[model samples]
Target chain A: MQRSRLGDLTAFNQLVERYQGPVYNLALRMLSYEAAAEDVTQEVFLSAYRALGQYREGSFKAWLLTITANACRDLLRKRKRRQETSLEEMVETSGDRSVSPSPTPEEYTLRREVQREIQQALNHLSHDHRLAVLLVNLQGLDYGEAARAMGVSLGTLKSRLSRGRAQLREHLLTARGTREP
Target chain B: MFRRRSEPIRHQRVRELLSSYLDAQASERERELVERHVATCEACRRYQEELRDTVQAVRGLPQVTPPRTFTLAQAPRQRMAWALPSWGTPLATATAAALFAVLILGEVTGLIGSPVAHPTAMPSSEALSLKALVQPEAAPEPTPAASDALESLAVQDETPPAATQELSRSSADTSPPPPEEAAQPPLQVPLLPWLQGALGLLAVASGAWWLRRRRAIR
Candidate 1:
């Protein structure tokens, strides 16, 4: 962090390489689109690079994820304003929906199907709930760290996480039942 | 009464604590309490199962590698770009202040003449008349015979004879005699423009130095 603040490009790039997966994953889950997630991931790093001076001592991962969340919210707002669509509508209309490649075509199809279902369920949640789930469940941050990232109280974070998980469970179960029948 | 009103809140709090307990995020005491409560509470037990499943499903989602390296180059250029606004704001303000000072100096030194000053160009004649109007003691006294003659002329003209004669006599006595004092040029301070210019140059130089130091550090 000290070297990065002192304008060392190598140090900053090292930090970026270490955290890009988690940042991109957070963006992916928050946005539900591959291309938008990629764009937001890049933006998050660039913004973090510029604001390196303001970085304080703590979990660098939490700080970077906070930036990712804010960037995703901004893009979501822009998408909302442009199309006046709800989160569900935006998810449904998303372009270039793809997952990381699997070894077998059949496995890839199944994995993509499950990912799409989860993404849809995630999109069904309110922004706060979705963020809480992504930070805690997806990004693997603890309750306190997730709360810090979301800028909410610990109780609020737990509430949102609980609600978000319940909603996701309901949707995933319903989807499974429909497919099986 | 208060406990009755807060009963629902307490129940919700317990449920949330139980949710945390399922995730292993609750304290030992809270975990024991939640465990005890969930054993008896059918709805909470169901909620706990749902939360567990939700977390499991989320964790089961695929994590993807980044498509490409997000490594950044052009460190100096990017740093400069960010530095622009931080350095630019105060420099812009200083430039504005310098321009304002120059404009004021220009007006003061008559390089940019004012409208009020233009009307007062023939200062000698205007000054003499103002002096005469303002100094009644300097005027000569009116003669008795002259006042009597003017009174007769006013009566023939059928005006307020005595009052008209007194006003005429006073005007004639107080009318300024010309060409007594020579016109003097207004005072000019030679140091003013030089001082303003030096100050403006100093501000610009300091601002440039500050920006240069910022760029070098980056």
Candidate 2:
């Protein structure tokens, strides 16, 4: 970090510990594979360490997410080569997998269906569009931060999200065999 | 189908501020603009809801807590800050400086000569050496004072011959001032040039030295 105050490993580690969940979550959604997401997350932190000196004030998180996004992209390219994605190998990380005392069978089935569709829709997207959708819609980043995280201008962020969301909508609709809006 | 009204295809250019904005990244202006547009624009509003659903779906993605936090405190790769010890830099700088001075002073003074010469001692050869070590020694220092007024006059005035002739004439016309005084003027004449040349060289060398020191500090 440019600030000498955060120059030590302790501070850097703190950042890793604090933001890892969100960063990993974002990567998981974009990459759609548990292992690849974790790998990308590690690569992102490694990159963040290498680029720590270049870190400017007030943009640390944006800078970090940008790295995370790029790492996701690289993994995607590597995945294309194998033609066998590691998606099925992913350990199910259902946050709410524990039996609920008051869950109706319908709700459980609906959630399971939604999860499958979400994963399918995300995988269907281009990296740019997937990342745009993940950061803005799920990660709750604004256009500017998402744009920054994606290392794009605000316009590009909007375009990707627009296209990405549209694609996602189409995928969800088709999966449900519902009429297109 | 979406239709164009007189309102002119009014829709938020941003259907939804992407998911990252949820973490408080948007400027107030952006939040307000998106808020207002989503309120009035059905297309953007619907997109916002869908965007929300999509993001929520992703969030609900199975959380794969890797068996370990992959980033376990693998000792941080050594950084330049750590690789370069605090004291090591100053030592390196000092060694570099010593080498730089040796090389430069060598070129100027024909190598292995006296490291520095006094201004009033012998300035003629010293000034030439400056143009010689110009690369390392061009930094100028404030001149303490003019070293030799007479030598300066000699080089600047182009009257060395006339000065010599006058000295000869004075010797022939009058009895030399007492031995004590006779030795004084002659001694003073040579020193004037030596002083001037020395001062100039010192000024040039000091300036160069100052710059080197400054750069080392950085």
- List, residue by residue over B40-152, the lDDT tens digit for candidate 2: 87877776676666656655555444433645365456344443334654555565566557546645764233334444433366343432332123324313232233335
Off by over 4 Å in 1: A84-108, B1-14, B76-218
Chain B TM-score, candidates in order: 0.34, 0.32
Give me the candidate number with maximum TM-score: 1
DockQ of 2: 0.15
- DockQ of predicted candidate 1: 0.31
lDDT by residue for model 1 (A45-145), tens:
88788777656667899989988888888888898888865555545312123344445877766766776788888888888899998888889999899
Clashing pairs in 1: none
> Can you give the lDDT of residue A75 in candidate 2?
73
List fnat per candidate, in order.
0.53, 0.19
Cα lDDT tens digits for candidate 1, B1-218: 34453645655767768667777888889888788777887877787777687777788777766677777875635543545455565776678567667657777766543222233444354444433443344455545665565556556776644435445555465454333322334334354666767766766765676664433222
Off by over 4 Å in 2: A1-7, A86-106, A178-181, B1-67, B70-72, B79-218
Query: How much RMSD separates candidate 1 from the native structure?
Result: 12.3
| lDDT of each residue in A48-146, candidate 2, tens digit only | 665565555555666677777767766767877878746544534454532334358898777666776777777788888888877766666767777
Give each prediction's root-mean-square deviation over alpha carbons: 12.3, 14.7
